[model samples]
Target: MTAVSLVDVASHLPPERVGREYFERYSRPDDPLLRNPMFRAPEYRRYAAREDTGADLVERAAAVLFERHGSDLAGEIDLLVTHNALPDVPFLGSGAEIARRLGCRPAQIVDLHNGHCAVFPYMLGLARSLMRDTGARTALLCTAQTAGRIFTQPGVRRSAHAAVPGDGAAVGLLRASGESPILATEVRHYPDHAPDVALKLDDGRLYWEPGTSEFDVAFDNSKAYNIIERGSEIVPEVVTRVCERIGATPKDIDLLVTNQPNRLLLRNWGAALGIEAPRHFDTFDSYGNLFGAGVPVNLDHALRAGRPAGGGLVVMAGFAGAGELAAAAAVRLPGPDRPATPTTGGPR
Candidate 1:
């Protein structure tokens, strides 16, 4: 039997760190958003240069993973999946370009558009199922969030949302080997909430309309409340459900990684799960919100800081938009020997 196992994770955060005050030129010190808990900015967050597109960040991150794993990994990938928050071009994904640049010709590629901020688990689950059915030996999954580009626009630079996110990309290598077997993956979608999130302009002009000014994300007070309420509820629920599938409780999770949009949500999630402060980790302060990329980037940061990703269990989870989608994935870290034990999920 073949089981998909996580090889390792790598991330590339643009080196330029911007402080909250950077938004002052566009906004104001007395701005109500400054005092709002959700909009309260972190001390500093990384940003990609204006010229840097989402594909650029993904390439750099994937390059780091390839360098660490050696050049041979480039040729071994038979499947590639990419989910970029701000793709370079409209109406197309960056999968083909990424695969081509990385020398993964003849690779089957997927450009996922729906999963949004908490898309990592969706990527993982899809990769596992595809590799299993196709008998593919290796797969590369990538996610990039270009907040630097989106927030810097004339339409949004002054808004509090501009200060709440960072720019970065992350990549994870999964192979048919079970050195660190994936225990389970689960996902749920809520189409009703999808419309709750949309673009906002100064006037009624549509995004593509000629008269449309720079647009920012906008929702009414009630919808905004629902988004927060739903996220707070669904994130922990999915994580707990994932734990149950593997015959473990939240206490068994040695490490928990999740999308870090704000400090409140991060705190609430751990408390609800009964997970200790030390057991759960987030990069909200350092990198801010990296969208769906947060899961892999945070995981990489934790592992590099010597957090134990091995010798125990780890779970990653998050919800996209208000609750348009939610997903969670669990993995059993290998012991010192890193055995090749199989999971029943592989191509049956």
Candidate 2:
């Protein structure tokens, strides 16, 4: 039995909006995926920073969440989980940094490393296990990414991958409670597809390699194509399996919140899952991909907009960059003993 209920959620998005026009200003007409309508995003939010690290983004996001949900859970947080694809600091853990920043001294801190897309579902299951083992009462599950500095730099500006990533962070407060329970969580790794996405620092310059091949080969544009081909199939499979684990179907889910691959991919995924257009929430179009922060940030967006009605069953699913990893979970919002409250963006 899972012993977790998400009580509140919040995120911090860099105020700057980098639109497609900005990309067009630097893109060549024949630059394949960069300008293609099928893969292009109109704009994405990027946090502007001078010396701040990924830790800063995580702290700012948590602060936003605390501003709204902190008073009640501040002292109750006994566990802290942080996830980030690119840590601003080397060797040191973001989880500990976040815990220290929030002054959660007694809380146990751990970091989830399943890329940016899939950690939410993985974290849910992990949090449940941790609480049961440690007897912790509350867990702060947080994710943030500030890859704009790396992915949008001059070296990447000439590649097809430059247009896909953005920056932001999200924090979710999950408590061990009988209220607003988590029905089930499922995770699977397809390491066979792990080669689809990668980042290499070669020749004194960094390059994001995102694609696959039939045989072992070096980097190129096909890597991106490989991800598109493979991701389209596995993401939906994991979502469905997780739903079945909870004795539910895609039709039974009120809202399907997954990673921000792109608006087109998300729409296609929704269609593949037999979900209606309105039932799925996406921030990829508006914020690009915030990597690990994608799931929680999108969930917060839906909650703020009053989605997944009272007692609604919300399905959260995500796939990481490696293509081998995926996770999904089903949660029912608005506890039976309490009514829906907009303040927490969660069940009351």
TM-scores of the candidates are 0.93, 0.88
- Point to the candidate with the largest TM-score: 1
Q: Which lDDT value does model 1 have at 155?
A: 51
Error of 2 at 168 (Å): 0.6
Model 2 bad stretches (over 4 Å): 30-32, 35-38, 200-219, 335-337, 340-348
Tens-place lDDT per residue, model 1, 17-121, is: 887777767885555555556666767789898788888999999888876667778888899989989878989999998987888863589999788788898
**lDDT (10s digit) by residue, model 2, range 244-291:** 988888999898999887776687788899998789888776888777
* Model 2: residue 150 alpha-carbon error in angstroms: 1.8
Model 2: how large is the Cα RMSD against the reference? 4.6
State each model's CA lDDT, in order.
Answer: 0.82, 0.74
Among all windows of 10 consecutive residues in model 2, the one with the lowest summed lDDT is: 210-219
